[model samples]
Target: MNDSKPTPSFWKTPFGIGATVIAVAASIYLYIEHRNHLLALLPYAFLAACPLMHLFMHRGHGHGAHGHGQRDDTPKRD
Candidate 1:
């Protein structure tokens, strides 16, 4: 008796084809309906991304050694 399962064909499967059609249709509809609104928000999105980029980019920096050659406040015993 054979015991082999059918392999999935991603883009050719029913769900895959349906999802592609739905995505394409939604993209077309949104572009036609809200293109101007989306374009207006582009500059604000860029402005917000600038500070986030700097914070993330410099997160791994400014970590130098400290407490070198500095005297402690407590007195030393003879």
Candidate 2:
């Protein structure tokens, strides 16, 4: 039986060239269409989101790798 995983193709990969191109294009379009709105909210939005983003990220990753050691919280038997 084959246990190996198949590698992702160009578009299938996360944050690949295609994704980057799409994101850049969208950003450019938004900037052109809503330059004033973007300018007004960009800084405040970033500042407002910074603390919440940090809390969210830290909460999500607080446990160490390997899911904080064990699936069951109770002590394990030998």
Candidate 3:
């Protein structure tokens, strides 16, 4: 029974820690530097999110709790 677990990846190494810190710092710096530019896109971002949110939340929607995926004899919506 080969039960050996896989080795830890990048995040577990010292170099990875440094890289993560640099990435976070760069992100914060860029956001602060271009805060106005990012803010200008908020409305478009909100519009884009509507359809995405609807698509995810509406999965298996008509199928409810007990009657999921089973079709009804009558062509009527429950």
Candidate 4:
């Protein structure tokens, strides 16, 4: 007699199923009620702050890929 149970796929898992249900419900509610607010602010907010956000995003990496102290071979100038 077979005793093993079948394995569950992604949405069959508890967290996955719960998250899917929540997302669908939230989307339906938003579309039925708050869609105008979501639509109105999203594009303007994205456009206004995107460049400043990008500029700051590039920082904190600090000098080159090999750290600030180490130098790799690149043919020394003579």
Candidate 5:
């Protein structure tokens, strides 16, 4: 049987390194130039994250047949 590994993706190649360097430089430039505008929106970004956090974090709460303040009396398995 042949034993060959798959090729690495573009993000793992030299081009990806160049792209990452450009992206970091651009981000640093933008952050420096738009410091005031970005900082001003920080509070709104947090306020918008509240509902998103609740929606994502409350998945296993079982909001359907299992009512609130009730415990699951089922036996535990090893």
Candidate 6:
């Protein structure tokens, strides 16, 4: 029986490294060229995040199931 190690993922290869370098360089160039435009949108981005935060933050709370005058089934501790 022959045993061999698995090949590395694409991101771990030389070509992937080159591509990543290029992508990061491009991103830096773009940000430098449009810093003002991007910064101007920061407030709008924060506003958009508010609704998303509310939606995700309440997901585990089981909202509307135990609140609003409804009696909770959990036992009260002394």
TM-score, one value per model: 0.45, 0.49, 0.45, 0.43, 0.49, 0.51
**lDDT tens per residue, model 6, 1-78:** 779989999899999999999999998997999999989998999999999999999986768766688878887464
| Tens digit per residue, CA lDDT, model 3, 1-78 | 999999889898899999999999998997999999889988999999999999898986655544766666765565
TM-score-better candidate, 1 vs 3: 1
Clashes of 1: 0
| Count of clashing residue pairs in every prediction | 0, 0, 0, 0, 0, 0
Instruction: Give candidate 5 misplaced runs (Cα > 4 Å).
Output: 49-78
Q: For residues 10-30, what per-residue lDDT tens digits would candidate 5 score against the true structure?
A: 889999989999999998998
For residue 77, give model 2's deviation from the true position in Å. 13
Candidate with the larger TM-score of 1 and 2: 2
Candidate 4, residue 56: Cα displacement in angstroms equals 14
When summed lDDT is taken over every stretch of 10 residues in candidate 5, the lowest stretch is 59-68
Cα lDDT for residue 46, candidate 6: 99
The worst-scoring run of ten residues by lDDT in candidate 4 lies at: 60-69
lDDT computed for candidate 1? 0.83
Reference-based lDDT, residue 75, model 3: 56
**Which candidate tops TM-score?**
6
Roughly what TM-score does model 1 have, to 2 decimal places?
Answer: 0.45
lDDT of residue 76 for candidate 5: 45
Candidate 3 error regions (>4 Å): 6-23, 56-78
| lDDT at 41, model 5 | 95
Better of 4 and 5 by lDDT: 5
